[model samples]
Target chain A: SQTIHQWPATLVQPVGSPLSLECTVEGTSNPNLYWYRQAAGRGLQLLFYSVGIGQISSEVPQNLSASRPQDRQFILSSKKLLLSDSGFYLCASTGGHTEAFFGQGTRLTVV
Target chain B: GESVGLHLPTLSVQEGDNSIINCAYSNSASDYFIWYKQESGKGPQFIIDIRSNMDKRQGQRVTVLLNKTVKHLSLQIAATQPGDSAVYFCAADNQAGTALIFGKGTTLSVSS
Candidate 1:
C-alpha cells in the first residue's frame, strides 16, 4: 500500500515570513504529484503538479512554488507569505491511471 | 475557460433517506470523472469514479451517474447516515489526464 505524509499538520506564520511544506510518498515510484489549496468554503485550486523530478507545472500564478527533489519527495515553498496565502494545502499522488490518493492536509494560517 | 461546477452549495437529508448531488462540467474533452468526500479538517477521500464511456458506476453504498450529452454528473448516496455528512466534490480529468479540475463542493448534512 502507498501512503503520503505531509507536515507540519498545522502551521502559523507571520506575514512576509518564509514558508515550507513537505510531502513524501512511500511505496510508489515515478508517481504524479500535485499541490492544491482550499480556501474556507471554496473548492480546491490546483497550484502545481509534477510529472517527474525537476519538472513542475504551475496551474495558477501565485506566491507559491513547488519542487520535486526526488522521485517520492515534493515540497511547496514561498519566499514570503501573504494573508491571502492562508488555506488548507493538500498533497496528492496518482499512478497516472487510477484514482489519486491524498495525504492529511496542512492547515496554514498567515497572520 | 473550462470548469466544473455544482448545482447547490448545501444539502440536508434525514437518516435512511437517499441523497443526490449534481455537478456540471464545461470541458468536452474530459474523459474521466471522480467524486470525493471530505470531512471537516480532513483531506478529501475518493468515494467513487466513472469514466466518460460509462453512464453509471456503483460502489458499496454510493452511485455515480454521468451524462456526457449534457455534460453533467451526479452522486447518489443510499440510506444516508450521519457519518455521510461532509463536503462532496466532483472532478474531471483533462484529455491528457495530467491534471484534475475540481468543482466547488456541496456540503451534505445528514441528520439522525
Candidate 2:
C-alpha cells in the first residue's frame, strides 16, 4: 500500500514567478514516480516520469520539469510559470507489484 | 496519449442503476490497464485494474473489462450512488512499460 502526499492543495502564482510542488511516497522503495497535469475540462497529460533517482523522462516539452531527489521524493519545478501552466497537477507512483497510486493534487492558477 | 481538447463525455444515471463508462486506448503493446475515480479538486483514486491476459477483473462494486482485440477498456459500477459522482478515467502502460498513459475522463453524475 503506497500513500502519496502532495502539498499546498492550491496555488496562485504570477506568470513569471517560480513554482515548486513536492510529492512524497510512503510504503514503497524504488518505485516509479510521475507528474501529470489536467486542464479544467480536459484529460490528464503526462509531464514527466522517473524510473529512479536522478532519472527523468519528459513526455512533452513544457514549462515544468521533475526530479526524484530521494527514493520516495519526487519534485516538480518551474523556473518561470506561464499562464498556460495553470491546471491541476498530480503526482503518481507505481511499484514493481502495485498499481498506480495518485496524490491529492495541487491546483495551480497562474495569474 | 494526447490530451483531448474537448470536454470529457458524461454519464448521468439514477441511484442504484448500473453505470458503465467506456474508454478506448491507443498502444496495442500496452499490457497493463487501470481505472481511476477522481472527485472535484482532488486527485484520481485507484478503483480497479485489469491485465491484458485477463479480459475482466472485479472489485467490490466495480468491474473492469479489457478488450485487447479492439483496444478498449470499460468500467462498470453496480448500484451507482450519488457519492460515486466523479470523473472516471482509464490509464494504460505505454509500449515500453515505462510510464502510464491516460485517456480523457468520463464524468459520471449519479442522481438520487
lDDT of 1 by residue, A1-111 (tens): 679999999999999999999999998899999999999999989899999999999989999999999999999999999999999999999887568889999999999
- Ten contiguous residues minimizing lDDT sum, candidate 1 chain A: A93-102
Off by over 4 Å in 2: B1-8
Q: Pairs clashing in candidate 2?
A: none
Instruction: Name the runs in model 1 displaced over 4 angstroms.
Output: none
Predicted model 2 interface RMSD: 1.4
lDDT of 1 by residue, B1-112 (tens): 6689999999999999999999999998898899999999999999999988899999999999999999999999999999999999999985578888899899999998
**Residue A80: error of model 1 in Å?**
0.5
- Writing each residue's lDDT as its tens digit, candidate 2 over A1-111 gives 889999879999999999999999998899999999999877898999999999999999988888888989999999999999999999999983358889999999999
**Highest DockQ, which number?**
1
TM-score of chain A by itself in each prediction: 0.98, 0.96
> lDDT scores for all predictions?
0.94, 0.88
